[model samples]
Target chain A: MKQIFLCKDRLIFPWVRPIWVFLPLFILIMLPTWASEILSVSGFGTLGYQADNRSDVATIRDLSQRPKDGYATGPTWRLDSRLGVQIESRPDPRVDLVVQGLAYDHYKANLNNTITLAYAALRPTVNWNIRLGRLGYDAFLMADYRNVGYAYPWVRPPTEFYGWIPIFSVDGADAAYHFSGSDGIWSLKAQGGKSQVWMPINGGIGGGYHFKTDNLATLSASWQSASWRVKGAYSRFTSASDIPLLAPLQAGLAQVASANLPATSAQAADLLQHVSLEGARISYTTLGATYDDNTWLIQAEMGHTTATADIVPQGNMGYASLGRHFGAWMPFFTFSTYRPKSALNDTAYDLGATLNQGLRDPSVYMANSTRIDQHTLSVGVRWDFTPRAAFKVQLDTMRSHAPGCGLRSISPTLRTQDIHLNQLTATVDFIF
Target chain B: MRPLLTLLCCLGVCSVAMVQPTQAEVDVIVSPENPLRTVTASEVSDLYLGRTRSITEGGVSVAIRPYDMVDGLVRDAFFMNLNGMQINQVNAYWARLRFSGEVLQPSHLPDAQAMLDTVSHDHNAMGYVDATLVNDCVKILLRLGGGAHVPPSP
Candidate 1:
């Protein structure tokens, strides 16, 4: 993947604008005549709106988006809106070529993030599949398909589980072995690759961070019956976080450590590790299951992520949802939560109090910088009004616990506590 | 009592849904060159759901090319017989697999006659159509229904 700056304003392909979407649609109609045997084109999009609410903190769809207003000015459409087009060419039974370009509120308005997926697969035999190129991660249950709103029940997948971890696509290779028997179908997949992503900072006040993950590896297995599926995956990756906002803190810690003061030497060293995210190793393990009996849909997933760096918080997140279909309408309910393994580091606070005067403490904010805790209860309904389209409206009541503001972009001014806020969101999703 | 009431309401909806418009019998037809004489519903459903690309028939793994029709009624009836699924569930199921592009969906033809034309030309190709329309060009691998379903004629 090419390195793109978080503030790079230049479009990689200036001429490839939104108008170019029509060019493919025109080509799709004429394609059957030109290369009907090998070519296929399809697309999906969501027109969404987040209803206004009084939020003490700046709410974001995920870590990848920066809402325009830092203070809950009004309703936002870019929070949950996206359009994607996929082109697949299968010239032979054993070969597959796919390129999908998605347009969303990416951290960087660049083509690298716009063109999300481009991969090729080759089937050596009936039971073996080998793929290479830029592929979506198959770590979670809906990690790859979450962008396609029409494919899932909710307006968006639970943000607690997906917001903090934004590495969606990896540029590398994977192999899968599939076999089926009288009981069920089973598959084993192994993936290894490198990935780069820019996650947003403090909404509009702070910018974003461009981080790269090296030696990313994942192993996943699944067993599927006619109406039930169980999947589990384990992944490990190492990332170095170079945050410009925390540069002052890092330098301060380094200065204190270098001085070798007896009282603050160990504290400085530990706080330096807390402030710097260099050579951070993160491991994510997840287990998920789904049961869709054509009449009822039930899904649940639990994930635990651990990191070696104190700056990178270790945590657990999970969600369970149930939905039932009645003709063209489906009503659903979901509960999701995220709990950090450890609260704010007392060592950072102790060193910060030591650095600052005992009266006003900036280290208190430092202690609360990465601490996030929250749980949400959601009720939603989906109306499949047409064959190719669906309209969904969901109401989510969130409780942002004290000492943390969940996954919101963080700052001293926007730090909210133990407050409840209700958000209403609606989306019309379609695929063609 | 509340749980039972909820279950009763769900059963009532199911009972109402069971009353659907009658259609014709859909025959899962494949090329006569295919080695397998017949297939089970799960085997056919697996292909339709984009689960497996090939199946072992007569001790040999044979790659399959499934064909779908533009006629919505016959298509719905076929899946309804294969698995108790409506068209929306089927479409959403395929949509979930669309991003990976790992699962190969059955190519869509204009109508059943076009399906027959394509299936007859390829030994691996298979399709479903009105049982009355079956001819010597393709052999019946499975039968999905016995309704009076009339598909778009050639």
Candidate 2:
């Protein structure tokens, strides 16, 4: 009884403090400048509809059906969009404040109703600036500007490539100091913080563990010259495992003992298992570069991760994109891939087994552990209908492959042969 | 008599074009503090584009005050030299940074007077108005190397 209350106390209350901290800052920045400032409000949204011709590939449900090529699958996914407002104290150069709200169905499923981004920045000297409260990382390319359509050439980032490591933004504090010389210009940024997240797998044997990490850091540098510009960044994520939920896996007899309990009592017994929660380590690294001139922008990135937790499957991913701009529009294309070093375990259950028989083979109870590869091709365009706003549309074709599973009922046939999935999306993004 | 009047009108227009300010004077007016010691066209482009970030000695923040879209010289010199990115792209760049809670847009001025006010207050701020409106408040950093702007005065 005490434990449940403690979980709620530890997890639930800490997140709410930031919201309270943010609201007053918004009013404080706006209250003084209301008369002279421009209350600029803007928003963007994507009404995405996708159809899966093959049920075994990228379907939200009924993965075992393996429907025929022409089968009709209902378009099942959608997103609730986002909007923000910035109160610009125009003629006064030093201070400006922004408040934004983002809502997506997937995030909301875990009771994350309104993701708020609010902050105040003081640029005392143009070369040196410091911002505090709910700041996001200035990651390579996609990490920083996922929303603005005009900044990117593609409709959306290639999912097959980026889907491997899914942490999008960080909430923290960041500072930048700039230096310029005859040879080139250089800038540096230092940022650190923690974020609340939901992983696809739990920390135990089946998937990922539920907890937050402490070691998050990013260091970035850039040099600019007449003909070209170069930049690179490195970031790390380290998790400390202390959750009481991970213990049961180490006790062989505990599994047998739990099997004998009534279903309801078994649930209580499972909470007693905490072995896997002990000292699991996790981290990842990223690097990127970009060069652009009058006609083109070329960019690339490579990233890798090492994790002690079984939930995080470690691997490497890389991508390259090229784009060109026309008068009011631009078109571009990209190619990228994700390669997993080892497969995650697959779990299956056997109803026919005796109480002592335990679960069937590990593969039957957990996800299949095998090598997987993902390849993607994307093409898209941006149209600027107005000076401050633009619209973008992009489409991608992805193929994922695993080895040796041809079952129509038990597996995604991509294991036997490459499976194809298509995504089409349109975004209306703007700034004031 | 009619022919004479017509000739006078053509001469008036031609003289206006010829008297357009040179690139050096424009440079002095854009950023008054920085000395104009034979800077290259590339240097001018870098200053306005926000890419170079600093000047001859140190890394200085490049302040840009974008004029209304219809402002011909602002579009030609700023956007053309920066990255060939249209106004939407520039706006998007600031927006992305803004949404990320990184930085706000560089100070925006509605007209030449306001731009001059900003430039006069900060040595790092760089902007442009009519060549005829040049003043002692700000030094001309560099003249935009393009057709719309007049060449610099010797």
lDDT tens digits, residue span A323-424, model 2: 786655668788887776665422222223442243323322232322336667878776665565455676777666664221112243235566677766
lDDT of 1 by residue, A217-242 (tens): 99999888899989999999878456
Using DockQ as the measure, the top candidate is 1
- Cα deviation of A336, candidate 2, in Å: 1.3
Query: Which candidate should be chosen as best, given lDDT against the real structure?
Result: 1
Can you give the lDDT of residue A266 in candidate 1? Answer: 73
Which structure among the candidates has the greatest TM-score? 1
Estimate the lDDT of model 1. Answer: 0.75
lDDT of 2 by residue, B1-154 (tens): 9998896566445434322333322332545664433445555555544544344524333454332223234543455543444455556555655566555545456666777776787655566665557677866544553444344655
DockQ of 2: 0.23
